[model samples]
Target: MHHDVPLIATVAMAFVLAFAFGFLANRLRLPPLVGYLVAGVMAGPFSPGFVADAALSAQLAEMGVILLMFGVGLHFSAGDLMAVRWVAIPGAVGQILVATLMGVGLAMAWGWSLGAGVVFGLSLSVASTVVLLRALEERNALATPNGRIAVGWLIVEDLAMVLTLVLLPAFAELLGGHADGHGTATGGGLLWSILLTLGKVAAFVALAVMLGPKLVPWLLRQVARTGSRELFTLSVLAVALGIAYGSATIFGVSFALGAFFAGVVLSESDFSHRAAADSLPLQDAFAILFFVSVGMLFDPFVLVEQPLKVLAVLLVITLGKSLAAFAIVQLLGYPVGTALTVSASLAQIGEFSFILAGLGLSMGLLPEEGQDLILAGALLSITLNSVCFMGADWLRERGRARFPAWFDEFGKDRQLGLQGQLDELRRKSQAREEARSLQITSLIERFPIFADLDQAGREDLLMLFRPRTAQPGERIIRVGDRPDAAYFITSGTVLVRVSGQDIRLGPGEFFGEMALLSGRRRTADVTALDYCQFQTLEQRDFRQFVSHHPELRQKLLELVRQRTEMNRQAAAAQAEPVPALPAQG
Candidate 1:
């Protein structure tokens, strides 16, 4: 039967499955990349209902990988790359070589052919940019030192991987005894292929650059003038896909590479973020499916059969690449923390692994096992790369902890000289909430309770004021309940009922301070009957704060004393009868 399933049904099914797994992964806090991979495994040939058309799925995945690479290129500007190149270049290359060598050595030891060994080694050496990028974003580390280096490393790896994809077929064929190292006219043929590919690449870049700057910007300007979002979206897609198709058809280069260059060129224009915001969501969906397709290639049975080979590859992926990257970054004059962290983050096989494997299969450089191995490595690499990256942070802290004593006096002491400059920037970033906290603490410290504290006590108090959210109808304080914390509303409102009388408070009004100051039960019942947010100072923090600020304590004591005196005055006034005046009829 040559009948085919509708594209919508197939793609829809894949998406539904991807969503289900993604949701599950989210619930578990596991990476959604793992979810997509698991989705593929569940929907694959080895599973119950095999619905994937390998060729169709693979073609879609190819498009996805291309777009993903393009996305990477788009986010990373040349300036961004240059800033972190020192760490990225050596870290990425070092990890790749070490992992590759480890993979090849393991294969040889396990009696696998040399060609397969090389392919496996190379494949396992790269990490998943998709996973790493998402993880970095989640951790708010994307703009941090490690994130920049990580992105740079992956960009370099992609370039290297693409080059290897171009060269691997010939290398493998030579090693596999399928062809002479040099063929008759091989020199001419090879040179011609190289020149043609390069010429097309150069031509595409030059043409796109020329056309993109003038044409794209002009078109975008017109679109902006008209203010049609739909048209703008269509135009962006057209630009991306049109450039992609033209490059692929004319030069025989991967559409993915073309899209990447297109993004880079577009980056020079003003519409970059706007386009990215609109288009990246689309890219993310397809790219996830692309990962799922890679999972479709994984056969656990094969790995089980070749368990030794798999384990060996895993070792190379983890240990070999880590060491390789560390050595390279250290050699490049980076601090040990940056060197190790950057190295660990980049140590794994990635998107280009599948790209190379597919190219190799088409060119006869790799057999079925080689392709499968690459696929497995890609999935596992994504899973573990993030783990290694997390370890990199820990390793960084350790490196600083072990920072040389004199490095502080000569190297780091100089950084301390800029403490004022950094402080200025930090103050700006601290925003209003942080500024408020600082102001309040400074005021509190002027009181008797906190006046005696040293610098460290102030630092400890600063850690207690993270923003908190409250649900409608949630009680901030229940009258007569032991108050373990003090609530100061930063925004939103709360209803206070003291002795069955009601009062309302809005921003900057504080409650439970009496309890906090006196270590007593809440005097009022306060409830948030609407969406609200607030900050609470914990009991321990309150006590510590009071202890440190003696003046503040003395002031609070005086206020409490006044409150008691007022209660007595009220009682005495009540005891005295009110004088009544007679009115004339």
Candidate 2:
């Protein structure tokens, strides 16, 4: 019925199936992106469904990439990237080189030209920004050190790809064994071409620096003052799209790169968060469309027709790239968890790969089969990357439990081993002290008992605390014991047994305070259920603190009374007691 309206039909089918598959994927505890790809497949001409307009879908997907990169630039800070620069820079470049070599090797074995191999290899070397960001966002790891490393690594790869895209055509004859209609570039010509490309890129950067800071912020401010949310959102879109198109048309920069710069320029403004929030829905919608567009390009028959070849490509993309990344990260003295996260985040290829392959085919450097194989590889790797993350996490946890001795044994035994060991010990000690201080400060800020204390007072109180750790099943406090200390949990879980009742406490929670304030024996037993880290305040320190701050005594007395009433109310609200479980040793 809607056949005449191809664009409308396509958009409608894409969204409808995307939602259906997204819901199904969610039910199965998978990323909804998987479902969006499936929706694309269903709506594609290859499947027996209402075929969507592939051209229109691709254009919309481009918008998705623009918005997605813009959002990433908004959250990404130079400081965060620099924090992991040592590992990220070398690691990303090294991994790309390794992956490219692997791809070239594969292509040579398949009897393809070196040019085709370079393009194929380069395509597979870079990870998809969308996929990596989505994975990190899902795990809530985007702000973590490892996430920063992964993101920085991605930026490096993108830069490398951009350079490759610029240089490939100039060196086509040397690589492909034949030149296109354009005259072959001599050595001098190649050098000149490279220099020209760099000049243009530098000019773009210069332009951005000159105008972006003042102009972008001013435009956003004007839009903000209009008191119209719609106008503000429209302005953000206009800037993103306008800059992207301008970069591509005038500066020869890619749309994704342009949009990223636009976002970076806007990020300096105070309204950046608001802009991000406003653009989120559109960003998400287009992102799904982007995945769908990629899916529509996939031909499922490749898996059946060239099973071994496709499998080999997938292995190179998923395992080859990941192993290189993992090795590079670990070699830099980062923890196994960080290495795993970085590696898993990069075990797939996407947008850039498609672009590279398309260009290669157009230049007659790549075969149709090469493009098909690349697409198939992208699909398989994206699918398996999710499992790769789960596997890495599992391995990390297993390593922590099974091989603690071997974990910290690396990156030592150099000429400065003694100094390095001393420095390591100092860092660990400082970290522990800082953790305890933060825990104490948080407790002071949160509880009514310490509410009267100012920030300085809390800082003074922090000195009375010391860090402590307890293994699972260890008894930290026993009922009826007169311990002259109070404990506040900093990490992990503890089980509290009181008057035949069991209560679980987690980080920032306190115990032994009631007994300390009441001047009596402990009323409950506290036992660690996991590897717990906490802070302990000793009786002597507490007494000294009270002596210096006499007003705290009155506040403490009032807190004790309030706690007593609350505990009484809690007990009254409890149901009939169940049989007590046997205590763990």
Candidate 3:
């Protein structure tokens, strides 16, 4: 029974091999990513046995890139980037230039064309987002000052690559590669292409920064109100994927860049934490596919065919790029520890390198061997990236002990200043989280009706509540007045006057729902007995929430019925007051 299910076959083989190799890698104390890559190699066309569909794997890997970048953007705020801009901007640029120069020099010695050399050098200049994020996350340094700097540096490199990708085609004919006829090799056309690409990128950024925060949050809240976990998760994924896809299609930017901005926009919303939590599993799984897909691209024959060339490319990626980053950071007045961390974080090239090399090959700018060398270098460097971090840690410790002055004297003040800013940012983030937690806790404790809500449900309820306060003797509701909202008393007391009877209610009690449910004017007068706090759910919001949660709606209906009976009894007793008084006498 044969079926046309290449995608399923690819995904299954990829996962199975990844798990097996990943398990073995863990047992051997290596990064599981190393094992994942090895698995991909085994399932690749170059290896024996089954060959997974490379195209499907690549597409899946693209999704992984999109989601991984989105996840990173959720945590990385503009404030964090600005905090380390002084070091990140110049350091990243300077390091790229240095690394590129080194690559160009090496390529020159091999008598390659200038275009090939430039493409090769540019490919080696950038680091892998997936690898760096994983390394930082594993060490719990993603939110650290150094980590922010490294991430910020990577962002700069990504932006540069985006521009390079745009300009490369425009300059193809000029640089000895056949142009695809979209752009001219003339200087004016090159300038125009550059300006156009920059404009598109800027427009996309502006739109995301200006409109995305407003729109995405509102959409999320709307979906959240539906009380569907799957829908909310779907919505989050939709927003991520949609924005990524839209930005790329409309703005001519990379999908990774687009997804990143989508995340940054959503990060400003109150639901950011929940969104991040909900989307994490998918992001991680897809990110694993990214590693596997990368592995599938490796032509291991390059290792045997051009050993020295492969080694040279690996050196440029690992040693050359790292040393340049280290020197640039130190020169930019960052501490040795920071320099080491940033350096190690960037010791491997990834997605962009593959993209550039592929483009180069398509344009006939780079030879096949160049592409193979880049792939081999990527594979080897990624595998050894963990060791690079370990080495950096060891070197930092040794340096601290042997040359304490280097750590103490170099960039100490600047490092402290950056640390202070990072701490402030972290404190603000923590405070917001605590405030949200306290809100949920208070709601569950004070309101039994809300006790059954899960975290997402509680968060949705919180969003609907419009907080209110009333002073003593203030009439919150008047007899025969139209109901606008239902009030839940968080604190203080209120008196509900029905007929001649006064019913007192304290914290956790609520009023104003009877009129809302019955679709009539208020039948009772409610006044604050003392200073009061309330969470008022407006009629529209109340109906929407209640509709989504039928159980809660039923509970409210029951309360309304009970209140109606109590009112009737009170009125009847008031009417029979004369006979009651006579009997008492």
Candidate 4:
């Protein structure tokens, strides 16, 4: 009973505490993320209860970071980002600069080193992806123009943070921290180290861009063809983990960067949606672990011992950053409402802050207090993030009432143009989806045999169908040819000549299956009577599909029996023709 099971114990306790706190947080009308952090605090070494293994928690948390970043990359849309780039790119960068300077000033007042100040400032600059998305969703603004700007703003911050993570280690020694494998070099030597790091990252990106799209998608398609859900899921995990590990080991890049690129590459594949859906649960679970582990690093004493320091960090996150974002958006000629929404959205730090703090602490660039302050800021800001949204809304309503002309005149034309572009994009996306749905619907409506299958089965059948067309007099099947596929006529007619008898198949009818079912060559020649359209199901797919749906298989078998009897009677009558001719003479 005393066997060493730290992994199991840590995982089990983390989840249990997370659930309890998460449920409580939900009932309190706060984000469940708040509860997850509380759970981590309860299980942390700083707390009095049973402590989880610190090392094990850290590794699990690392995996959480990887999966979290991967999810980010998977959902990254270039078109969406481009739509709001004019406001988002500048606004986010400006806010980051203002927030970082504020944090650095605070750190200096506390007698911390410049390196510590830089790391601290950077940590407070970015907002939590989960918190902002959830807030937007709760307000039903996720699909709105303001929501798009906020999301695009967050993406810029994430990209900046990724580059910082890559370059931080290279300059760690120059920043007065212990070098992490990059030897302490001054002047040109330091420059070379930075260049080397950038070079490696570039190389890795190049390889990922070139090979990943080709290999990863091919591998996924192969696994998908197996019709095994578990295998497909496993393949996704393998790609995420494998690429991350490989990049870190071979290319000397960070796991976060590697995983992000992996997702970006996979996102280009047709399987991206399925891959994201299947891997979501695991990603969410690991993301929770990540939050819990970050909580464990927090020392509650910091809140009391350095109350002003914690408050200062919160100001940088919620106030300084928000004002900067507001100003930048206004300068870009956006409406006041849009500016406030973007500002409110950036008023909290989450995963990236914790990640940056942990890396800085490990490299000796940031003090323990810096990490503690970041954690405190994250908890307080996340808890208060909802209030920020409410405040923005209150201000917007008041502004609209008090200065109606100002609201109408400011950015009115620009706003309309932007809204028009967004509407067009949405219409195009919806049209594409509707077209695919219509095709599936038409297939089932035209062929009642497919009506028996459920939604998923119908979709699978659609994927298996190969569309084909033939002109009048075109031979679709030749006598004595091996049966390879069964064709369903969707338009016009096809003539099947069997044993000197001619049979016509119009829309919704099928031919060429008799040989496939009987394991023989074609017994008839099928020729198009007019221009025709068909959906052909290959022999392999047909067998597999019918095997899964026995009812459909039975129906096909019954048709085969009826056809065989009809052919037999025709042949028997042909043989008795001589007797009929003698009677006539």
Candidate 5:
């Protein structure tokens, strides 16, 4: 059954295979990228010839990487990254330097050529952009101080990538010492080649930025008008691939860079979030292809023959990058602990590193086996990074001391309201303890009462209202002697009987305020409707707490006057009605 297959058939085959592997990866709690890589390996040169069109696969994979980077740029806002520029700049640069040095040293010891060692070492310094951003978003940490610093640091990495993309090829070509440098078409000689490369980058960025605003937004607006998800997807795909091609062919720059710039321009608009949500499926499809293409580059034989070397390289990528990032963030003035914790979020090889290595191998800077090592290293690092993201909360809990004060309640500013925040958290912590205590009969929460309260206010309120829970049939309050305290229903319902007339009251509906405000005895009886909960505030506590929020000075008198008038009218009618009835009789 082995026969020639058309390009379409092979591509369709890759998609189906990619999906199946991605599904398995999810079930195993691993990153889908890993599965895609694994799928590519199975279909690669060393395995069965499921895909005969290597060139076509490579093209689509290139598109996939560009789109992935573009998506990254759109998701991040420049203002957010700018806030932590001071720390992010030096921290990211320092990590890159340290990781590269470690990588180069290890590669040299493993008998890799100086040129290949340089390429491999630099690759180790690169962290997975896809994984890092995804991890930050998942943890709701993107808005946290730590997340902000980490994202700024990531931007530094991306800028470095741009420079690296330009320089690495130049370095590799120099290493070959051959005038042709593996036959990459040069516009002229060495000077001309360097100038052309630099010019392409400049022109591509300038043009893409200038035109992207008009083109991308308009295209999306049209797709949005159609309201067809399929069209939106197709438009997204065309934008990514079309722009990538223009950069590579016309501008003579890196397509990845073009895609990234395109994303940046589009990010400044309102539709950025919408674009991210709607086009996610398309990105996933191509990104999987890109990852699998990376895996296909890995050679199992290389790892087996040099397990120690392979593992060492992997170690340098993971631990060395992590440590360097941690140290750098501290040196940049962030607390040592916060820096290290954030660095853990970025200690992996990125998808773009493989692109660089693949280009290096084709251009003769890196050996094929070195490429294999990179592919495997990327897989291991990405897998580990995903695990790190998944368990970050657990990690933070266990190693809270090692992180910044920013994660703690005391670390941040007083924006969320101190007493209220702490009290809320404490309540959540002791929910079970406060669940069954019957010291208080009734409880209620009214937004109006808490409108002026901060976290501290809530804590103060909790102090006033000793919380209690009641089972069904538990009597909460009785209309009798002067009520000692007013009940606030925190949750559940209660029965209210005013002069034996029943009225149902639920959460947020407070009764007995009339007695408390008027200095009168209880006018109604209240009882829990079901398994109920409440917080009771004593009369003295209510006065003290309420005075601080809005001192009763004049408003309290007004409220009292209104209540008195209503009660007087009701009482007069009740008394006079009896006389009228007697006259009628």
Candidate 6:
């Protein structure tokens, strides 16, 4: 007699194989997602090894989609979505339309049904949020302007897909596809189905927006106060899974949509950052399983049986979509760098494509062969996207180097319009800075030297100071470097090391003054303890200020004398021997 243990066996094999393959892929400088998918194929029924429960894997994959969408919502807000709307909204939607049309043309060539063509086209339209984010993060470009546009474009695609998932069932007949279990609805039935679906979606969004924002954050805070790391992690998971299930059960919304709204509601909270951190590991585990599940559904024979068909699909996804984006961004007057970055970012499809394919297959709108082709295209595009990015980077660097003068002129001309807008922003920022400097100058007046200065004299002194910034662990001043200016700490701390001594300096402290006055190299290494902002008075500026203020000049000399004597004494103390140690011995 055999023990029935499908769940344990499948999970165990999936994890083991995924780890081995993922490690190898990373070692080869490839994305581990490729490895995970390969692992799934090996464990799938199509391959020779132990096959996982297909049904169970599908359910797990759905959970991954839900959580991944939720994570997107958690990190993004309406403001963020709107920030790049000028490019992202039109760019993403237009690219999708173009890609879908290209896919339709390919499907027509293959003599597939309109329903199959629509499904296939949709499957190629959207890029994987996970893959795109990972790619941008790897290149340290996620915080750049192009990255923001890419992310915003992704949000639009996600929202569109969520809408498609909801309506696909209601409009199944129109698309020449069957509805789920129930027969296809038409006329009044179709109208009712559409209204009901829309109503449920609206209700879920309303409830989540109204109640979830308050309750979820409060609940998370309460869990946090319990001071148990395990409980906090559990709470985060519970919120994601519970809200997802409830939305689907009570409101008839898809799990992915529900979870996305749940995350959006929670994103409003101050504790959302911690919540994201707590949920990361669980999210990652499910994401890996998700890729594995997609792999399990893929039939490798599709590549051999229909090589040209698969190539056509890959072209639509990688080339068609990328070209559309590049053209759209360029038309919007962005530089070539921004256009290439956005274009390259969209050259791969993954999670969303898998979801769309699965849905279409379940609805009988897409065939098994179609699903296999989609999976094949996704794999190839993802692998090749790396190569595409490397190429883009090379061209960008070489273009800048080889045609520096030409590129400079071209870049300047392109930036002329942006420069005007930037100038307005700069003026506003300068006004704010001047206000802040006025406050600082008032504080400076409390010092003995500045007390003698009249209002105009103090204003003149402020004009001589220029702002400087340093990041944590940055060396602001190195030993043996000739000093040009003395720095006045405005905020944060710095550590100054001279001869074997370390001195901590806080706001209101100053440094490099002795070097500036004496025309000598710096004796100490000054490093920022944290992000720091300071103001500097150059030697020339200081001398000019002192020339007009003899009393302040005398005060500075006196302080310098005192500091020099203090340093001498400290050095003598450090050199002194410990004579009393003999008595202890």
TM-score of each: 0.66, 0.67, 0.88, 0.93, 0.64, 0.70
List, residue by residue over 1-585, the lDDT tens digit for candidate 6.
Answer: 777988888788889999999999889888889999989999898999699999899888888887887798888757656656777788888988988888888888888889899889988999988888889999998766667778888889988998998888787777788886677687898899999999988988888888998899878766654445578789888888899999889988889888888788788675676678878887898888899999998889888999998888888877888889888877776667767788888898988899889889888888888999999998888878888788778877898798776444544544554445445545665786678576656557434457777654565566467799999999999999988888888789999987667889988778888887677898889999999988888777776667767887787888889978877888889999977655664
Q: Compared with the true structure, what per-residue lDDT tens digits does model 1 show for residues 91-142?
A: 6777778777877887687676777777767777777677667777877977
Which run of 10 residues does model 1 get worst, by summed lDDT?
A: 406-415
Candidate 5, poorest ten consecutive residues by summed lDDT: 436-445
The whole-model lDDT of each prediction reads: 0.68, 0.79, 0.86, 0.89, 0.69, 0.82
> Which candidate should be chosen as best, given TM-score against the real structure?
4
Per-residue C-alpha lDDT of model 2 across residues 1-585, encoded as one tens digit per residue: 545887777778889999999999889767677788888888887889588898899888888878887887676566545555677789988998999999999999999988889988998898888789889998898756567678888977876776676567667766753345766667887688668767877888788878998998888766554445688799999988898889888877678778878888887565676788889899898888887887787777778999999999999988888898888877877767778888898888987787788778878888878888998888778778889999989988898788875454543332134334435545765786688577666776545466677654565455446789999999999988996787878799999987567889988677877777667898889999999998787765665566556788776677678767766777876855778999999
lDDT string for model 4 (353-378, tens) is: 99999999999999998999999999
Query: Lowest lDDT 10-mer window, candidate 4?
Result: 576-585
The runs of at least 3 residues in candidate 1 whose Cα sits more than 4 Å from the true structure, single-residue gaps closed, are 1-4, 110-118, 166-185, 398-585
Clashing pairs in 6: none
Candidates 1 and 5, the one with greater TM-score: 1
**What TM-score does candidate 4 reach?**
0.93
Total clashes, candidate 4?
0
Q: Candidate 3 regions off by >4 Å?
A: 444-449, 467-485, 490-500, 504-507, 513-533, 538-565, 568-572, 575-577, 580-585
- Clash counts for the predictions, in order: 22, 0, 0, 0, 11, 0
Residues 1-585 of candidate 5 have per-residue lDDT tens digits of 855566676577777777898799879987777778888888778787674367777887886888787788777566655556666777787778887788778767877777777777778887877777777777676656676667777788887877787656655555552324365434455566677678878887777778878888877765544434467667766776677777778876678777777678778764575567666777877887787777666777777887887788778877777767766655554554355557677767877688778777776667787888888788787778866554554656666666546445432343233324434544653663455222212222353545445543443354456577878778777767686766767678888766435668777655566677778787767888887776676777666556666643245456557756765666666566444445664
Q: Which should have the higher TM-score, number 1 or number 4?
A: 4
The lDDT, on a scale of 0 to 1, for candidate 3 is 0.86
Error of 2 at 6 (Å): 2.4
Worst 10 residues of 2 by lDDT: 410-419
